[model samples]
Target: MHVIIFSWEYPPRVVGQLAEYVRLLAAELVKNRVDVHVVTYHDFLTGAVEEPDGVKVFRVANPVRTHVGILTWALTLNQEVERAAASIYYQVGKQVALVDVHDWHFIPAAVTLKNAFGLPFAYSVESLEDHRAPPANTPYSMSIKSIEWLGFYEAQRVCVKSEWMRDEIVRIHAVPKGKITVVKPKANSWIRDILAMYKSMAGGAGKN
Candidate 1:
């Protein structure tokens, strides 16, 4: 099985746990003979593509713009991810097995990829725009929230770290109550949860 993962950060570009989590997940998947491809941002000195531990990683450059807000940068980053992914999808001569996308940071590209390839994407929601208390409804904030809504609505699966986040997803995005999987962050359980999520996603795809 193959999974194309999208994230804003990865090893050597460590934004948070997301980067480290993805690194561990990809390495473990490779050991299990699963083809894991990561699409992320290129940090200061890393090349566009890195093949660490047999996990194929494509990093797109997302340089900061002087006047543009973070959303604009995110959109531009999505374009880079999409272009690289399209190239790989054609070169491999196989449809991507599943799209494992992380948050709204990469939703623009993930949505396009899913629609273009007719694949179901599993969204990992780390946080939500609406759950961030006051000023969370500002223009930029609301825009990101809408993107999150679209992600939940379009996803075949949703994974979250805590029940609070799961509730936030259901309440804020209006996703079905039973659709979210709660995965703990402990090292041992996280991998099992991810594997189960992948199986669920793959099984759903088969039904389609």
Candidate 2:
């Protein structure tokens, strides 16, 4: 199976847990013989394209370097990511079976591609914006929450790192219990196995 992943960071561009999480997961997917391609924000240090591991990597420019806050950064970055993804999609002949997005940062791109290509997308919810911010929601925090909710709404399946998170998602977002899954990352477990199970249940929904 082939999977296209959109993230805000990747190896050598690591900003936090998401970069490491995606790197390890995508590498494991490659080890399992899955076609894995990653599209992420290009830092000034890394080139536009490269293949550090077995995974194909594409890096695009982050729209602005100014400090406009997380909301603006995410929005601008998503636009660039979507443009790059569209170019890569047609360039590669659109062999991508599905889009696996990491968080709200990738929502705009993932949703755009899903609509353009009729492919299903999965949301890997690491955390909730509301939970991350202070009790009183500001405009910035609300923007993040809105984007996060939209992502949960659009996903064909939602993968959470823990059962607590799954419950939180259901409670906060009102996503059906059946659609949320607790797919905890484990050193002993193969991401391929988990992904295979997901695909088996996903059926034709994930493919174009």
- lDDT of the candidates, in the order given: 0.79, 0.78
lDDT of 1 by residue, 38-124 (tens): 888874543446475999888777655453687888887788888877877776675567888887898888788778877788898
Q: Estimate each model's TM-score.
A: 0.89, 0.90
lDDT of 2: 0.78
Highest TM-score among the candidates is held by which one? Answer: 2
| Candidate 1 Cα errors over 4 Å, as ranges | 43-50, 63-67, 132-135, 187-189, 206-208
Best by lDDT: 1
**Tens-digit lDDT track of model 2 for 133-162:** 765288887878788888888888888888
